[model samples]
Target: MSRARLSPALVVGAAISVVFVASALLSLVWTPYDVAAFDIGHRLEGPTAAHWLGRDHFGRDVASMILLGAGNALAVSLVAVLLGAGLGVPLGLLAAARRGLIDELVMRASDVAFAFPALILAILLTAVLGPGAINAVVAIGIFNVPVFARLTRGAALSLWTRDYVLAARMTGKGAARISLEHILPGLASVLIVQATLQFSLGVIAEAGLSYVGLGAQPPAASWGKMLADAQTLVSVAPLQAIFPGLAIVVTVLGLNLLGDGLRDRFDPRLDEER
Candidate 1:
């Protein structure tokens, strides 16, 4: 596709993703302020030369915490998406290839999983696993499994009957080999787009879980946790809530935009135009 023909949303989303990735990488090296350090005397201070994004209730620098929170959120969401895709794709391929009892069992189980909303699932898991980043990853990862499995199965089924797959079967290739070599490559574009969409959903799920005290615990800066902490001070410190909320909003928007653009790019009819 020609670069000039790319949608504006694609450009913006790519820029946003790059910005967040850079901020997260920088947080690994250093933050402008010690995110955990408390200076009660500086509490709720507006943005100033001293602190680019001001300070929170505990007088922690908002910019530094925001940067750290981006890293935490991205880590959980990315890992969750990877876990989901890893587990889901194989199950989906198995179901598609077997197409009998195995398919029925897997698809039915996915249906049962889909019944529970991500937030509810997070809360339930949190009760058993305890609140923390790991729990958040597990909760979101589980919620994502059904989505990926269903999407993969639906797409794989269409390709299963294609001429190439039939030829592979005629050549005595095993189901596993055909799936890995022939099937997976065909599903790459759709899966890539799905991954982007799922990453956004994972972020939203993690943030919601944290907001309700079921996610990343205190002392660990999380965007959702930051918003939760800022709630009580909304009247006096609206920036606390506003900044984190904007972070979530922008990140999700960017992922969605990128996913949409990818969908268009992978479609043969649309690709022709570019």
Candidate 2:
């Protein structure tokens, strides 16, 4: 087997993702200072040898907070995407296999889901379930469901019309078997690209929810919460906000670039053009 070619964007994106993942993992084991520890004297101090990214208004080490915050962001995004893809992929596959009323129903349900924005859905869920990381994940996951479902349905529909799919049908292969063995494999690249894009969106959605006090609660050290806290002290200590903001931007950019790279790599039309 030949090794797959790596795109420059994919390499850079993967590097960025690795760095963040490593930081998050390291934070799980150790942080320079207690993420919750506060010192009035050190509050809002600029970066120093002792505290690389300085301290927040509460005197919590910004670097430590960011490190741990990465973990929170990744965890939420990962769960959200998993939940979305887990349910959405099946529904999409089922719809594609059945077509007619089932497809209409699935697509219509997705439309209804798309009608509500993530933030609004988050707020609604928070009202019913109260605020936390799980709620945020559910909200984001719900939002992602329609996206994957639509993409899967479209991709699977195309595959269903192909000669191999017809041959499998003629060979007495059930829809479920054919979808699992054939359609799903063909849709893997597309799903992967979609997942990357959705993961980034989930991260941003989690941050937005957290910023609005609907995500990870106090002492959790979410990037969004950090930004929310820093907004009041932006002028006095811009780094507090800057560090978390930069984290969000870098994470999203990396995922998006990775998705683009994967799309270019997987799409045959793009290969033909090259």
Candidate 3:
């Protein structure tokens, strides 16, 4: 197998992703300053020895808030992705294993789900449950369900026709057994790549939801909420918006790069072209 696992994209992406995760985890124990601490007298102060990234309108340490925000964003996105995969994978396997009315129904249901974007779902949830990070997770997770289901079903369908799968069938192994033994493993590479892409989307969606007051309540650091708070003052305190905005951009960029690298490394077909 062509081993491009350590390609430039992978190295850079991994570096960025590692930083994102490390900084987030670090915030759990320590940050430069208390993000919630407000020094009204020092509000909007320029970057100094204490505040590396300057201060927000409330004089909260920008760096500290960004650090905490990373944790919040990561938690929401990670849980949402897990929730989606947990439910979608099984449904997809079942549909692929028995491609009749069940398959049609599963796919049709996914289509219906696709009709409602995460924004709509988040809004609906907010109306009933009020806005919060947990609600954002559910909304994002629901949106991701059809994505994994479709990908799994497509990959599984092809695997079902493979010689190994046919041999397993001939050996009288049940569909469930054959799938777990033969089909699921084959889907891992593609699924991992898709999961990475979906993760980036999840972060973006969470930010969008938070901006509209449909996610991450007050006192909880969130990049989108930071952006929302900074909007009116962008012309005067551009850094307020710049820091969080850059965080989102860089985070998403790293994830997309990682997904692309993983796709290249995992897809053997690309070897021939190279």
Taking the tens digit of each residue's C-alpha lDDT, what string does model 1 give over 1-274? 6644777877888888888888888899899988768999989999999898899988999999989888888899999999999999998988998899999998999989978877788789887998888988998898888888888889899999999999999999999999999999999999999999999888898888888888888888889999999999999889989999999999989889888887776777776775
lDDT of 3 by residue, 1-274 (tens): 4674467887788788899999889989999998778899998887899788999999999999999999998999999999999988888999999889989998999998878876777677666877899988988888888889999999999999899899999999999998788899999999899999888888898889889998899899999999999999988989999999999999999988999888888888888788
Using TM-score as the measure, name the better of candidate 1 and candidate 3.
3
Error of 1 at 200 (Å): 0.5
TM-score of each: 0.95, 0.95, 0.96
Give the distance in Å from residue 122's predicted Cα in candidate 3 to where it truly belongs: 3.5
Q: Point out where model 1 deviates above 4 Å.
A: 1-4, 269-274
Model 3 deviation from native, Cα RMSD in Å: 1.5
RMSD of 1: 1.8
- Residue-level error in angstroms, candidate 1, position 272: 8.2
**Can you give the lDDT of residue 52 in candidate 3?**
89
Question: Mind giving the per-residue lDDT tens digits that candidate 2 earns over 9-28?
Answer: 88888888788789878888
Cα TM-score of candidate 3: 0.96
